[model samples]
Target: MLEEMVRPDVVVGGYRIEKKLGAGGFGKVFLAWRDGSPCALKFIHLESVGEWGWRELFIMLRHEFPNVVKLLSHFKWPEEKPEYLVLVMEYVPGVTLYQWARDKNPCARELVEKLLPLARALKAIHAKEVKHRDLKGDNVLVREADGAPVLVDFGAGTMPGAPRVTGALAPANLRYRSPEAVAFFLRENRKRGERYDYSVKDELYALGVILYVLVTDVYPFNGPDDELMAEIRAGKPKPPHVRNSRVPPALSNLCLRLLAKAQARVPDAEALCEALEELLEEAKADPHRWEMVLCYGWTADGRTTDDAPELVGHDSQAWLRRWIRQKPKRGRPPAPPVVAPAPREPPAPPVVAPASPEPPAPPTVAPAPAEPPTASTVPPLRTRVRRAAPVLMAVVGLAVVVGLGLAHVLGKFQPPPSTPNPGQSVLTSPVPAEFSPDGPTLWATHVHEVAPPWKPSEADAGAALSKADTPAPVTTVTLSSGTTHMKKKAPGSQAERAKKGNGSTGANVLLAVAAAANMACPGAQIRKEPAPQACPAGAVETMTRQLGLRLGERHGAGMPGEKQGSSEPVPVKAGPISVELAGDWDVGTDAMGRGGRTALPNGTHLTGQLCIGEKRVYGRITQAVTPTGDTFTVCMELIGQFDDERGLEIKSDGGAIKVHPRVEVKTVDRFE
Candidate 1:
């Protein structure tokens, strides 16, 4: 969210743009201060989305829902820059329910008790006209302040009584939506020419699911896409008691009622709250049942501290039947076990004539009680003992099973340490980005790496200018160029130049550098000639070198600086020659021992500067280098008697290497 902070162009309503707080599909929310008190500001994103926020705000204007995140004020973005549609609203500062759940995971007696408040808070939200389309753990922000949870992100949708958010994105909760909502939303966006309406029952149903998860830590329905949806919509959910016998029948019945698909099965939020309050009161009175519900729980992944039974099986059917058929509960005497008259004892005495007429089937005697039991018709000690024995044994087995399951879950299910590995890891950092109502601005965690000159230095200028020489036209070799008139020639060099008129000596120097460079920096190409004309607008080269290279003229090699004494645009040309450099070319050095810049093969001279930006750079690049094709360093500098200021500009053709420095390079036309 930090990434979203930007100064808005215009302030909306009375709130000045402070910084963006959070944002979503509809618009961005800002942390704003008014009259010296902090208030949240929400701005619409686009006109379409803004309309929805407008509608929702209108519907909920004065109504207040305690558990919901507060909505402060509304406004229209001041400008019509398609770029930004913004909004500002209340700022919520509580931890999300997901985080709370994670902290309190591995539900136990204490944790389950903690969940009751969250369940109630959800109940409150359902009471409000708003349906928190999303009821997932993350959507529920739980702050222990005042010992209650708060729901936030009162988001976008065509809420029950409200129209779509004029500026809202969309209101849909993927994780905890009810079956009907899920079907309605998934079925089609529009039906019968009207948009589908998400109902309030959906929220209540979601509330029931929340309770279910709180108790069991598992969704009643489980499976893959088609399978999971089918599971949610299909069969009867098992009672909570089935998962944890600690859950009393009363609570289990409540769960079943809420879970029932029949719309009337579960009451509305208000009624549900009343029922829950009663159940909770009862639970308080009965601690044993409460303990059991708390101790055993489930996760959607089938994790349970109690024996988890998938009730859709034969044994489950038998058990359910047995439970149903248990002799009418204690107080009700099962309609007096019908008794028939006792047969005559004489029939028994006639048993000796058993052989006679099959003894008349023993006269069908209905035996009389040997002894009249005290008030109760208790079964014999033996019969009673036998029946009670299995139940006691079953109880003992269940205890053992519960203990083992608890050990397995609690023993191994400790929270894993926070260390990410390749499989689930992505290179992520809090991208200094945040949500803004006016639209997001690009924010960087760090500045981009670049090359720039902070100081003006001859070495720097030369380095910038003397980029690699161009690929010369395939032609014959010749050289031409001119020198400034105002130089006090060095005696020995002057004598040397005069000794060899028209600089046959300079030509010799060129050939020598080219030859040595081939073997020295053999990989390096040295032009055996000089440039004939000026390069394009953005490029620059030395006049002497330009004329000497003769790369400009289309026709022929006019002459070398054969007319050195002349100051005319010396027509020039060069014969077929490959690029080469001297073996001992003095490379420029930086504050560090060595620099990457290499001196131009002696005869080459600085013609002019290239304008990169506000500055003119001397290393007017002649051409790009090979492979990745970026400008290589060059050696170029204008000669003057003494104090002349030099500046440089850097630039690129805007490709992979889009950035460069501002070197002050001067331009020249056909120079002699």
Candidate 2:
């Protein structure tokens, strides 16, 4: 019930809560302000605040490093209930390391300049016999005011006398676990009682993983849990330069050294700081090589290159916008505006005289003639010509039509034949031979005289003239008989059997051949060839089989009615699966969906939500999660209803409610 009291405008002790910043497995952190300065207030339930809570408070109060967050005050809230323990600390206003690198696109030299302070902070903490077991990108903050690095979140830290707060393995992200730690876990899982100790080398390896992602914009080993573990044990990741060419060789080597598999090969905190300092000095000597930004191809003039590599987990548009805004402007600055001297004041006009007992009207002066248009205002001669071209063409076309009509009425014009003569030669110039399935064929080169005009049966002068005005004759070509000839088929032979088997196939083949011929020589007439003959017994079947094989090679192999390279999805339905809630979940609030061992596969992620109806509550599956742990975004819809064992219970936080109910889920449609 204490969760209901955590919200904006609620004062815990002396600080007023502004908004929730983030939440973890144990508690939630909120941004709050007291007097005039802002601070972070972390609220933890008494039940969940075990030894780790006290451990964090002890480390924060004892430490005085400049690069670490300082603890201010702490107290248990609400004397009556006393359900939450609120800790107030100084708030660092900035983004996480991952967000900073993505927006800034820093080069190797700038990256080292920022990360050097983090190494020194680690050294300072290690000197006091304290170990920060979890060291990932999220734990480091780039301060908004000074650009200095500050380490935060010490919930998993410990000293010499700290109590054990975890099971066999320490609390850390799975992706940042070192190879040796993973091997130890695998070897000791079957033992009755065994634990793997988290050491300095493991912390350094986690830092290396952060550096690796900053340079390449992708995880070192990414896949399912099983495959990821296997690769971490034995696989070697590619160097940073291999993934992103802009990474400097020195920086890549440093990352590799920090991630060495052997514990002794990795450097300690002090040695790592020394190495970073040396790299910084070397960067000053070769500025050009070390100043290129990693994971993005950007030009000096604030433009992205065409050959830029694809970004994995960064927003391309947002990054490009930041680059454009932060890059220095090039070219010359504008000259100062010119100012002309003030003109001399003209002498006062002579005194005006009165006439007819009234003031004389001022003499009217004619307005100056308007200035002639300048070259900039007038259209160019070429533009004028372009605008009039279509009108000129239309006039010429009308004149030609009228002249032709006049000539036809006077019996002085004659049109060419619509079809060429059989014995005429149309090829005046040499051209390559036409292509045919059998072989190449040449055109005949003989000429013939034109035939006389046709005579009309009735004496209709208009009809005779219309017939004489036909279109021009088309160009014709002839094929050699011997090259394209096929044996004639006997009556009722194999040709009849082939036609009966599949008549559409033969027709389609002829159409395809005709289309090819037309495309080869446009606007030319094609003569009809002789009919093809039938093949011998078993020959047709062999040709059909060979044709099908060729088609299958081009378009994937399948039957006549089947589609290639695709399959229909099968609908999946699960019934009344029980899921446990980690924290108080309310209606319309999305949370990670989990089910019993037999309901869903491991690693599958389902985004779940609850919606209130008039009579019952509905459960919605907003994302699609397959049995193999593949996730896809889909349209949101209600899939099933919740059991009526427990209804909605309103909390005082806002318009949200909490409830525990069993749900049934079914997939409505497959993702695209």
Candidate 3:
């Protein structure tokens, strides 16, 4: 499987395949260069990776970057052959924490001090909207140039509102996943067709594990996957410092607090980074030990004893053998002939290279044309022939009729369905219901649920994913204050938090919205500097697509191999925003041409539109501003709607783009 992924021509997209960097069960990762920049190329085994799982990731953050693993391009060429999704990302030349810890086996004081930046980098990522769900030593890579650890592998990461299944996320992820993450990862109400949505705490918790490992140089809890999963599931991981006594009490306390199944105990990654920063400052004051988290077996005493042999020989092996013999006090077993095997050389592969072009003439011995077989002359049947003559005639007639029918049917053909996702609502974004004299209006555009493994594909799934033809479906949702309510919850999902709480008091702090924000997406509210119009009036028209993000922790779609294992997401939804407003907006998604736009129903329109295939979004209201202007105080807000799709978006008051280019097709930003 890994060999098939060793592409000789293209990496996915147009990036050239260079060399294989690493291989794992799910697929192989390659170090590649594209457009004169280096990026990590992650491939997926076609048989095991699910189509939707890959689509969801493509929809969310395939190309967005800076903090997240930027998806520069994706692979599509091997469509007809045994296919693989080649994901090209910013080539980060760094040592995985596993490699780092191993290289330094016992981490030095200098190495420990170097970890401050790693935490800071993670904080920076949290500031952006991405989290590293798989935060094991292997996933946390330290840049060789700066010694900063960047989180990679979002196969298990989630934008807020993404699904979290029990088996989808790795058990290692569970080790570092926060309490909110734990609760989300282990849902009690899945029987009611409910799945826990991943939250921000997922990243926070993983950050905690990273911090613990960084400080102590040992996994917070180490064991087999199932055993560790059970321990984490059963809350058996001892406080990080307990494994290493030299670990600072404050650091230990923080690690314990992070492991605590309490929201108040474990805060968000930002807050955790602050606390760890303080702890790291203290650890720097006095550095005595090194951390070797993933590597073990080499003991501190063994080094000194091992050195003794260099100066003075010690044959304890012979002494032990003499003690074991005992018969007639026999001295050594005749010193078994030390016949060491000779070193073998690695074999070289054979190669053939021709210097000149060969002539088109080959030694061809053509066989003579085959002679036609002579028809055998037979005697014609006469009258009063066999008694079975009528049956034979009937059989011949039936054969002729069947052959004719087969020919007629074979001549005709029918085209396959264009869009597989029909009937079932394949909503790109929710169309908010209007508020009336009654209670409130809430009309949600539901996601078409994944059908059985053998079910026919959805028409829209085909159309939305199709690059050949069929325009993607688009929707215009009214963005009134009412439509800005928090995302929905899976059915009967309260049991997880309810298990720890008094039912009425709501100790489910992890269940809060903050826990599961899209780790890699732009926020729901726009954040432009110098105070952008007081966060907008009525409802802030923020834009995001239904990417495969779970914000904090991602649940499994199914088992590994059947789905991508925490490395990449597949494109499931994409769209941009179109609106008219005075406030400035910033948008981000896990896709290209996937931005947002905003425009008031009848007032000045501002669209936060994302070009679905471009993975770029920009703009604010067309305001009269200069370097010296925008000082006057004026405010006017109007209700509007947002239109979007996985690839395109459009929304405005009335004028058409054809009628007024300036009024409609204004160049906000080309953030290439």
TM-score of each: 0.39, 0.51, 0.40
RMSD of each: 37.5, 31.4, 29.0
List, residue by residue over 1-672, the lDDT tens digit for candidate 2.
232366678888988877766544345678899998999987755544445667787787787776988889988777676766777877999987866875687888988998789988888888888888777776788999999988987777888777667556665655577888778766634465576777888888888888877766655664333344566676376676665566788888888887778554456888889889999999999998788775332221122111122222334332121211111111121222344445655656657556545455565555554443332322222222233334333332353465523222323222222332221112121111221122100110000010001111010111101111101110111110101101123356332222232211101112112112222222122122212222222222221221111111111111111112333211111111112111111111235533211111221223333334333333333332221212222222222233222222222224322222222233323211
Model 2 ranges with Cα > 4 A deviation: 1-3, 188-190, 297-662, 665-672
Is 1 or 2 the stronger prediction by lDDT?
2
For candidate 3, which ten residues in a row score worst on lDDT?
303-312
Top of the candidates by lDDT? 2
Clash counts for the predictions, in order: 96, 0, 99
Off by over 4 Å in 3: 1-14, 24-26, 33-37, 45-67, 79-82, 105-115, 121-129, 160-174, 177-190, 215-218, 222-230, 233-236, 287-672
TM-score of 1: 0.39
Deviation from native of the Cα of residue 222 in model 2, angstroms: 1.6
Once model 2 is optimally superposed onto the true structure by TM-score, how far is the C-alpha of residue 590 displaced, in angstroms?
28
Alpha-carbon lDDT, every model: 0.37, 0.46, 0.35
Root-mean-square deviation of Cα positions for candidate 3 versus the true structure, in angstroms: 29.0
